[model samples]
Target: MNLYAIFAIYFLMWVISAFIMLPFGIRTPDETGEVLLKGQADSAPSNFRPGLVMLRATILATILFGLYYANYVQGWVTLDMLPGYSAAQ
Candidate 1:
């Protein structure tokens, strides 16, 4: 793949990873028995950590991107393997 395509794929992976990681380590004030702020929503996480989430997302994205690149190089899967896909269309 070209450099730009690689970057784009990596960025897409990172975004998906970040979103997937967002809810894993979260804890609401009620869940942790902490006092909620005056204006804080009940569902808002009291112990949200962006740095940790970003770190986890980066690691996961890197691994996923590596696998994706390997698949691209190895041709482990192709469009024909997917149902309803036809190149003749």
Candidate 2:
């Protein structure tokens, strides 16, 4: 694929990875035994770290995108291989 296509696909993968990592490694103040700030939601995470989430998402997305690129180059899987897919006009 071209550079723009690769960049676009990788960006999509990164976004999906970020969303998948959002709920992991999170804890509410009550769960961590910390006092909640005024006006804070009850379920808000007291120790939320954007850096950690970004790091984890980057790693996950790299691995996933690597697999995707490999498949794209090798043609290991294709639309015709999927069940119920029809390539005819």
Candidate 3:
């Protein structure tokens, strides 16, 4: 695909990866036995590491996007391969 298409796809993949990675390696304030701030929720993470999360997300997204790109290039799967798909028009 073109550069713009690749970038768009990668951006989408990154966002998805970020969400999937959010819950991992997290410790809620209650779990860590830490005193919460006045407005902080009990469920808030004691050590919310945005940098680490982003790093993990980037790695995961890279791998996922690589696989997606490979599939796109190799045509390993296609719309016609779906169980109920009909190409007739």
Candidate 4:
């Protein structure tokens, strides 16, 4: 894929993950032997965290895209480009 396309895809992915996905519920045990659930599961150490999810997705996408593009020279997974105004005219 082209650089811009890859960037835009990652940007969109991040936005979706940050705004669309709901927060996960946290489950933990308190000192009193009771389930002490705090904020979302993304309480910094929670396994399933939503905080900075966009950052994570963007980073993952960028890395994968870079790897794939670097290894593939045939543009197998390249981004598709549409005709411009000049071509239409």
Whole-model lDDT per candidate: 0.95, 0.93, 0.94, 0.53
The runs of at least 3 residues in candidate 2 whose Cα sits more than 4 Å from the true structure, single-residue gaps closed, are none
Writing each residue's lDDT as its tens digit, candidate 2 over 11-87 gives 99999999999999999998999898889999998888999999999999999999999999999999899899968
Per-residue lDDT tens digits for candidate 3, residues 1-89, read 89999999999999999999999999997888888899988888888899999999999999999999999999999888888997764
Q: What TM-score would each prediction reach against the true structure? A: 0.92, 0.94, 0.92, 0.33
Q: Which ten residues in a row have the lowest lDDT in candidate 4?
A: 24-33
Q: Write the per-residue lDDT of candidate 1 for residues 1-89, one digit (tens) a residue.
A: 89999999999999999999999979898889999878889999988899999999999999999999999999998888889997778
TM-score (C-alpha, index-matched) for candidate 4: 0.33
Off by over 4 Å in 4: 1-51, 74-89
Error of 2 at 24 (Å): 1.1
